[model samples]
Target: MIGMLVTFTPRSGTFDRSTLEKIAGELRGPFDGMPGLRFKTFMVDEDGARARNFYVWEDEEKGRSFFTEELVEKVTGIYGAPPVIEYLDVVGFVDNSAG
Candidate 1:
């Protein structure tokens, strides 16, 4: 598996908790059952004025392919800032929900 972290640091007083929550709620349905996606989470640091998205994918290629230039531009427009995307090897994983 591979992990992708996308962080957004918009300017002060731009993006807020309510905006992040609304985005998350709207995107959750579309993201569910997405191809090659194992899991995804939207996180916000209200105090720090940042938002992040963590995604686990079946492979690095699938994860890398999902973050295209068009997607970045779209998200930048929505979030009011460009994101810093990072890919990482997933060394370990646990799913207690299966139990």
Candidate 2:
């Protein structure tokens, strides 16, 4: 399995509530259709300027595909510049429910 974490600053966090709604719509729409995607999670704080994305894919290629040239260009167009990301291998997970 492959894991990815991304942190980026946006061009403007001034999307307003409506713009956020639109983004949400797009996430569930064409954007989610990106290839090689397996799982995704997004984190945005109340500060409204910074965002983080955590992703998982079947392999390194899939994980890398998320940052495709086209995707990067389009994302930069809306969000700004580029995001710094780290690719990691998941070591282990703790489970307590069974205990």
Candidate 3:
């Protein structure tokens, strides 16, 4: 498995908690069934200064394939800045709900 973290600081005065929540809500359904994605989580800082999207994919290739320029542009359009993307090799994970 591979994990990718895309983090960015939003432009000052461009976003608030409510706007962030609304954007996340709108994205939920589409992202829920993305191919090659094991799981994903969208997060924002408590004061709404920063945001991140964490994703676990079936493989590194799959993870890399999704973070395209168009996607980056979309994120930039919303947050007013490009994200800093970081990738990690997922050594392991513990899923409490798995049984």
Candidate 4:
């Protein structure tokens, strides 16, 4: 499995919690059934002025392919900042929902 963390730090006045919530709401459905994606979560750190997305994919190729340069540019326009993306080897996972 592969895990990806994409973090965005918007400019001080460009984003707020409400905006983030709206974005998440609009995107949730499309991502839910995406091929090769196991699960994804949109998260925020209000105090830190950051928004983060965590995604677990079936494989490294799927995870890496999703974060293309064009996607990054598009999101940078929406978030008002470029994201810092990191990929990790998922050494461990637990999904109680599966039960």
Candidate 5:
């Protein structure tokens, strides 16, 4: 599996608990059954100044294929800032519930 971490700083006065929940609600349906997507988790700082997305993909190519310029722009537009995207080789993972 491949892991991806995307972090971004939210624009001034643009992020809050309500907005974060709204974003999560909007994403639930479309991302539920994406091809090559194993899992995804969204996180934000308690102060709502920053956010991050953690994704696990079936493979590196699949992971890379999902990040497009349009998507980047969309995220940037939503948060009012660009994101820093990082790809990593998933050396190991542990899921207790799956056991």
Candidate 6:
């Protein structure tokens, strides 16, 4: 499976916290269920300023799909326009994230 890591910097320091949560929440079912999609995630920068973050996509085609999907436009409405996204292959993952 192909994996992807997307990171972005928001336009400014004006991003909303709940908005980010809602965005992460909304993507759960839609993108997760798509063909070649294994998992995904994202977070705003820790400084609570710039948004340098990442998420994983399971396959190359699925990675490509995000841009082609109509949902890209929807995200801008909530998260602001044109955030930079990066794609990558997972060499490893350590999900020690506390539940």
- Estimate every model's Cα lDDT from 0 to 1: 0.89, 0.67, 0.83, 0.88, 0.85, 0.61
List residue ranges in candidate 6 displaced over 4 A. Answer: 93-99
| TM-score of candidate 1 relative to the true fold | 0.92
Candidate 4 or 6, higher lDDT?
4
Candidate 5 lDDT, 28-90, residue by residue in tens: 787898888989988888877788889999878989888899999998887678999999999
lDDT, residue 11, candidate 5:
53
Return the candidate ranking by TM-score, descending: 1, 4, 5, 3, 2, 6
Q: Candidate 5 versus the native: TM-score?
A: 0.88
Question: Which digits, one per residue and each the tens of the lDDT, describe model 2 over residues 1-99?
Answer: 778887667665533445545655677665375565666766665676766668777677867766887877776665554777789886764436567
Q: Candidate 6, 27: how far from true, in Å?
A: 3.2
Write candidate 6's Cα lDDT for 30-86 as tens digits.
Answer: 665666656566677656564444556566675766665465566556567555566
Once fitted onto the true fold, the runs of candidate 1 whose alpha carbons sit more than 4 angstroms away are 46-48
- Specify the highest-TM-score model's number: 1
> In model 5, which runs have C-alpha deviations exceeding 4 angstroms?
none
Model 6, position 17, has a per-residue lDDT of: 66
Worst 10 residues of 1 by lDDT: 10-19
In order of lDDT, best first, we have 1, 4, 5, 3, 2, 6
List the candidate 3 regions with Cα displacement exceeding 4 Å: 13-15
Show the colliding residue pairs in model 5.
none
Clashes of 4: 0
lDDT-best of 2 and 5: 5
Q: Model 1, range 59-95, lDDT digits (tens) per residue? A: 7788999988999999999888899999999999997
By TM-score, the better pick of 2 and 4 is 4
RMSD (Cα, Å) for all candidates, in order, is: 1.4, 4.3, 1.8, 1.5, 1.7, 3.3
Count clashing pairs, candidate 3.
0
